[model samples]
Target chain A: MKKHETAGPTLLRQLTYRLAVFTLIFAILDVGLVVWTYTSQPEALGEQLLTLEASKLERSPFLSPDELTGPPGARSWSARAVYPARANPDHPNRSGSLMDWTRRERLEHSIRISGVRRIERGGSPEWVWMELEADSIRPYIPVILNELLTHVALPLVPLLALMLIFNVLAARRILQPLRQAEREIERLDAEKMTTRLTEPSAPREVNALVRAVNRALQRLDDTMVRLRSFTSNAAHELRTPLSIIQLSLERLPESDHRTELQLDVSQLNRLVGQMLDLTRADTMEFDTGTILDLADIGRDIVSDMTPMAYSANRELHFDDFGSAMVSGHAEAIYRIYRNLVDNAFLHAPGESPIEVSAGPGPQISVRDYGPGICEADLSNIFEPLWRKDRRRNDGAGLGLSIVKRLAEAHHGTVSVQNMNGSGALFTVHFQEGMPESGDLKQTLPS
Target chain B: MRLLLIEDSKRLASLIRDGLQDQGFAVDWCETLNEVKLLRQLVQYDLLLLDLGLPDGDGLSLVRSMRRREDTTPILIITAHGELDDRVVGLDAGADDYLCKPFQLPELVSRCRALLRRPGASLSTVLSAGNVLFDSSTRALLVSGNLVDATAREINLLEHLLRRTGQVVPRPVLENSLYSMENAVTPNALEASVSRLRKRLKMAAANVQIRTVHGVGYVLFEPK
Candidate 1:
């Protein structure tokens, strides 16, 4: 896990998702409110003007059309007259929307009065529009605004702007603690789990969650200590007893039964050792393996097992393509090599030759001129405790499994395939970033 | 050598005690930390073999307390795990060595001998791994009977590598041995010495590779 690089969802996606939702709703309300105010403005003004004109006519008893002739049809304000049997016949009839169209009835109505008028003789009206022109009414031009910045839009745009800004602040405040916790968690590698996350300055609810996580870490630490203790004791307990057993067997007279018992005891000891390995594997996460020269690993294991190979009358040879390095846990990697080599000796017939080789871009391929593994068994060979040979119950099937697991842990891979002619080839390849695969290879025996 | 063995199981304890005694060790057996603690107050042993699960206490804590008290008796941890999470913690807490379970009796005996013999101040001593030889005190390196002049840093790195002969020594750790805070050494300087050291080492054989594990560390490889 790269500590500094963000791994999953980028922050940009989250921002875009939130901003998009906010914008859609903001735009809808902005357009809706503006249209409602524009349409209703004429009605609100018409009522005031109609009341004033009616009062004027009542006072004069016969007011002339000149009295109603103010500029009206061109601006946010417009005016139309409705005289019962006296006002123009083409004027609106008050059957549909008060101001339906730009200047005519989009509905069935004709006369529609609109007045941005003061009850006084001379004053500016605010806003109005008419569906029809009238004889006693007029259109006057006044201040107009950008369709986007109208009287109806004045508050809505700023309101939308305020919403965007406030939500941004609110989102950041809410996510800040979570982001900090994420960084702290990311930093908690196997090497640094001993450190605790700094308690977040968050709301009461999130603070409780942080405390819970800290408690979990404390529990993990305690459990690891106990596990280590058990591991330490288990090793101590097994080694001493095995030593004693081996010593006791040594005291016994040389006979067929004694030999059988010795073999049995040794097998039991090996089994116990493998079990201990299983437990120890847990603590090995931080164990970045030793940088291994593949040639060295192959040469040592082959030579160590060479005596066994020769006693079986088998020829064991190794070739190298110069120096190749791999990352591996020294002890575990040794066991892997030892196990593979030993397994080869077990399978290869007497007088059969075994070849081992390693080189740069480190790969170890060990071929044994034995009956190759059956094609059907290739996939299952690495399964723990899965033995391909049913006839030979000489051992547990953990050898290849251990090799596979150890190889993967080291950021390498192991595979078994039948050769073109005879024998099975076991290959393990080490990828880059293996415990330490960096410097140029230097060939040296010591 | 006189030694203390702390374990919990009586049956296993008796068996181990009898076996170790026959191996020429003067063994004082205790089943609990209390007994070990009391025994320590009364007499000093050359080494302590402590099982972490002594009935009365945490074994590491006991070792830690012993260290605090300035008791310099070498301690060996007998663990069931072949792998330890932190060697530094054990090393820091005063344990001189660690051994995993189901080990060969001969191996244990040899490790004990190795630990006991480690503190001698003899410059004439030569550590022989196969045909290769390295003298710790004099910083003299020998490959097949030839004396070689390796720089101090090279010798230190070589000695450290030789200490774990047939095993991998992580390059960073070797680097640290060559240039830890105690020795104001830099990586480039270590690299220069390693390059020089490699040249001297390669004179022995061909197809012998000291491989670089990309992005991790380096290990000294000796093919038998």
Candidate 2:
């Protein structure tokens, strides 16, 4: 809710952080699965097969050949037991199974008998148990894995990689408009209040936020309207009575009553006029917008006040300003001018010439030779009713404050610094124009 | 010289008319813009002191419309709104000058006379602030209509001051005007001349002000 705070995290940084997190977590899980599988059942199963085969070979290694079952009496009592015919198997058998075997047969089979019988385990016999179990269970494990490596994982790796890349791309796509909106908000300018956020076609989550900001701006505009009304009203209210009193004084004779009264009234009127203008300027919109010739306003106020400057023994001079133009209410811009010139005249003590100049950047500076404002007070000197010294009563203490507000309205800024030794320099800055069509235009207040 | 006053209020118009008549300037007054326009078309008044507020139309717009018709008669704007911008606008609208309201009638008369006399040099003849008047052509000085013989230095300073009235002529510029580009003048001499002039100007006879602008220089105010 604080004014001028920046929205956090730009799109570029958000994308980078998200991609890194995804890659890191994926690598961890992939390694974890590999480690878990490598330490499981296969190696232990291989060793158990060797132990069981040794035990089976020690019991009844040769007797199982005569009848192949019933321990020479368990099978074939009808045909009588002779040499079990190898030719009946129609080529050498790998596992000599003839009938359904119970769990006991599988448990009782020995590794010693496995070598003597024509089990066909000559080539790569170390994996015989595994081979036997695997052969009996399923063939084509190598074939299936080879096909998976070539036809599945090979293509899937690239597909998954593309998905991850697209995730980062998608996130940026989704956030791009919002990020732009945030940046636009960050760049909201008081001088450019007429400028609003070009609300993006964004997620609905952010729609209300945009609406809220626009509403806030609407309120500000409404407040400014009322403030201007009050200012205009206040000026009239003060002007009427002052005018009446002046007229009444004028009707009096040319006696001491007229002279003394007129002198005091003159001073009083000057003070009141300055104060009212200050109040009006304090609340006026920053960019009511009119292009002004700075060269023009500077020329006028300087000439008008020159007589005062001359009487004080201080010279008033304007340095050349070439074709410098500004945009703002002409009156407001003049207020900026009056404050700087008045300050210069008040301080210079007729010793130094006030040198006012406009620069290449459409900027202007007023230099003086009076004792400069204190460094501590410089920051707040533009605040209303800010008087460094309590005793001086020439002004209502709003001159410089009006200067600051008027400058801001033009989308410009003003700064003051100490002159070489005993004076102050006030600088007003304006940016170059942005090619607004047509020649310069000025508007009068309705 | 007869002067025409355009004002909307009856009491204010009569008050101004009476006060101006007492000063010996023939004063004719009107209470509305239409009447003022009718009068302007007929009479050849030396000056027009126009009030900005009217019963019928804007006084400023009227001024602008008059200028559009090539009416170059001198105009002095009197208004209740005294913002600097207003003064600028009035002048830009072809007014010869502007005065914020509640003015001294003597001041107003004097201003009209000055504006009328501007084509010539009658205004420079007399400094009227304290009834001090110096006549260059006659080589005479008068305070409240009584002639007072002045030292030659005072006379010389008064003549120069009158010519550059209402402008701060720098001490250097004044010195240059006095001594010329080749006169090797001493600092003490200029100070002595200015000091004597200041003392005499402040004397009750003239209340003629020759103010020293601290470090800058000196200026004599334009007579009002």
Top candidate by lDDT = 2
lDDT of 1 by residue, B69-138 (tens): 8777788876544443444556677898876554455556645655655544111356655567777667
Q: What is the overall TM-score of model 2 with all chains considered together?
A: 0.59
**For each predicted model, how many residue pairs clash, with residues at least 3 apart or on different chains?**
25, 17
Docking band of candidate 2:
incorrect
Question: Scoring only chain A, what TM-score does candidate 2 earn?
Answer: 0.55
Chain B, TM-score, each prediction? 0.58, 0.67
Error of 2 at A90 (Å): 22
Evaluate candidate 1 and give its CAPRI docking class based on DockQ: incorrect
TM-score winner: 2
Worst 10 residues of 1 chain B by lDDT: B206-215
Each prediction's DockQ? 0.13, 0.21
